[model samples]
Target chain A: MAKSIESLIPLSETAYYILLSLNVPRHGYGIIKYVEKLTGSRIKLGSGTVYTTLGKMSKVKVISVYQDRDRKTVYELTVEGSKLLELEINRIKIVYKDTLYQEGLFNEQK
Target chain B: MSKNKFRPFWSYDVLKTQDWLNDLSFKGYKLIKVNPVLRIFQFNKSESENKKHIINYDKGLDGYPIYIKDGNDYTEICYTKNFYFLEQISDEPNSVPSYNDLVSRNRKIKYIVGQMLLFQIMLYSFFILIVIIFTLGIGSVTVESIPSNEVEYTTIEIMSAIAFILVNFGYFIIQIWMIYSFFRLRVSNRKLEVFCGDGIDMSFTIPKDTILTKEEIRKLRKEKKLIKKTKVAWFYSPDKIEDWLEQMELKGFNLIRMSKIGNSFYFKTGLPRNVKYHVDFQTKKGANYFSLNKESGWKLYFTSYSRFMAISVWGQEYTELVPKYYSDHETKVKHAKKYMWTYLAVFLPAILFVVLSIGMSITLFAYANFENISTWMILSPLIMLVLVVELLFFCFKVIRYYSRVKATEL
Candidate 1:
């Protein structure tokens, strides 16, 4: 299961934002608004994209979705999902470090 | 003074009916009451300004609030069953009452069409049976069979037969009119879906160079150039049907169309390609359902008649990973269980009836003399027993499918 979780590491921008927004349980509409706000109104997700992505993530055990008291579908990331997100964040951090080193070398040569 | 008018099949197009009612209101006749069963519209003369009448149909609106303030724009005048009659209070054209959910309103239309289709089929079949019986009764009698003293009675019998035929003929004409209305309603419903921004643009134009004349098309059809084939099959479970459809597509049979009732599949022979199929069932579906699925590139293949407990078949050709509709384990299990329970609910009562009749027949056979019964009397229960066994087998398969779905909870 961990190895399979490793395979899910390069998540799409939409999926990553969706997972990030689901740190606290939120419905589809809430996730859309939260992601928009998080991205400073840059990444506005369509209901269709959010819906399909959530369905796929749920299928792969990355997230759990259920209906709340108002019968609105709410999504939350699972433990496996948290691990996947952590791995992705670490990969991004390493990429950022490598880019900083490359920029420093270019600056010295200039 | 009050005026009454019989407007049959007006509910087929609620918008048009609303417009007609508003027109009447403009002419001083305001709609007072409606007799849905008799298709009567009761109107009373009114000297007041023209009022906008809105006819709204929603099954969920039954027994709800009859009068809603709606920001003082419109108020519900009356409600019967699922139909709500509302009048615009502001008398402003733009301020007329409108449904917030057009998809559900259209769903009600689809439900009515489905029910009307079923009723039409049953009525036509029964009428045909009656006609056959009447013709047979008449054909079996000869002119000599009637005595001269009973000639008056024969005339009365012929007159009554004519009256029966005339009454049935009138009813059949009304049924035909209802069918026309249903067709129009369906067309309008498709337009509504597009209006709601949920319908996929399926309009494609034939290139000028590739256009064929009628004669050429007929010749091509005669030469079997069109490789379209239709196959008839029925399955109770969605999962089983989805797998079968996917397998068919894999085998180079690309499903192009489905029959109205959804039992027949029309496919065009093509190269084997990977395609994912999803059979979605929803008791109540909104426009969002279609728009969401359509946005993901799933082509709508077929949708069952009624929107209430409707089943839709969707497919998408994919080159890489197989697409999943209900990706989560819980949703997948729940869907399977829904199919199982629906089939069980429908077939259980039928199975019980067959079993009880068989039991009664067996008990009678054991007590009474067996020689008195005809061959058909004995054979009928045997056939029913076979049907009961087949239905039980089907129920078992559906239950097994549900359990299998539940077992994959990882």
Candidate 2:
């Protein structure tokens, strides 16, 4: 058996973005566009990258095929996927707080 | 005036050949038709425009419309068994970039290489088995080693033996060459850089001192001073493509096009200079992939079903150029796993065949000289030998591929 989800913490940026975009069911192309828009065009997902990521995510039960809408295939996050995204977001928030405090760039939050 | 011509090129020289096609387009000629297997291309006279022919290695035409929608005004021109040609005509002065991402491109490379390894193993095993069966059948009838009869070999038997040895020797050389070429390409390209791009259409400022005006390009073309030449090479040798292109540039022949399959390189006369060539594999290209590479100051020239080659032009003084796309260690390991799975899938059945062949040979030996069997009985041992050799060769290839992956991992 593969490692547990705990061991796979801190998902890659692309993987994290994909999970975040799957809050609503989105097709492969839709996920790409959504991620780009969310990141202000800073993260333009390549078609191959999205295809491969989707396959990997599906295999891990993190995401699944929502529907086969004509020419496009849509995917949505599973319960496990949403949980992972929540964990990752919290991890990022902690990291951000730690970095700012360590660098003495910010004071305590109100 | 319209003109047409037919030319044959090797299947591996697709990069230089695409460049040659673009050069022709620049000189008022456009590629119209190409036969993938025959490596033949047809070009017709046309007016010059800022057009680029993209030869990309991809599995199929799926999502092809995305390319058109990406805004290069792309049209599906033609395709070979593994690659498709997309022609992008832009009224703008420069070419639009490709749409493949670095990670996916790297993945595509590993996948294709793994699949090819599996195919070679399966093909060679079958071929060896057939050859062994035929040779043993013919060898048994020669009456050369029957215990009761005098051991005298016929002239035909001796000639057949020689032919068998020669054929195996030739096959061994070809296999070795394939491995060597692959390693050469891998090692030479090890220095390629992996960079993150902004994924936008932005041009780098070319050194103002080195810019060539349109007038100069036209003046040289009108002088009829341009020289063209073709060089053929083995399809697996992408390193050779780089070396030959560099050598030609040193001699003042600028690469113009690579034959559709990359078997031939077409060059035109130019000032002796330096150029760097790099290759990446991408089965499915994306618009952002091109935007990334173009943003990095690389030009996409040739693509086949599995790989694409790009070039960087600089003066002779420039060296130590970084590549735009390179597979990382994790990707290499993943590719290794893919190759291992394929090897196992084929090797399991191959082992069964070997066991069966050994059993058949034992049975044949038990019956040897005891039963009045036809000459066909003698073929058992030969077929077994061939099967054993095929398995060994397969193992060797698997090991080599694994080692390459491991080396990359390290």
Kindly list the per-residue Cα lDDT of model 2 for residues B208-271, writing each as its tens digit: 3323355764675677554334554232233345566678778887765454555655456778
Which residue ranges in model 1 land beyond 4 Å of their true spot? A1-110, B1-51, B55-234, B247-253, B259-272, B283-289, B306-309
Every candidate's DockQ is 0.04, 0.06
**Runs with alpha carbons beyond 4 Å of true place in candidate 2:** A1-10, A20-49, A66-70, A95-110, B1-328, B370-374
Query: Which candidate number would show the highest TM-score if scored against the true structure?
Result: 1
Task: Give model 2's DockQ, 2 decimals.
Answer: 0.06
Candidate 1: RMSD to truth: 14.0
The per-residue C-alpha lDDT of model 2 at residue A84 equals 82
lDDT of 1 by residue, B140-256 (tens): 533356565855667889899899999999987867766786677677666554543335322211113334455865775576543434444345556667778889889887777
TM-score of each: 0.50, 0.36
Chain B TM-scores of the candidates: 0.56, 0.33
State the weakest 10-residue window (summed lDDT) of model 1 chain B. Answer: B200-209
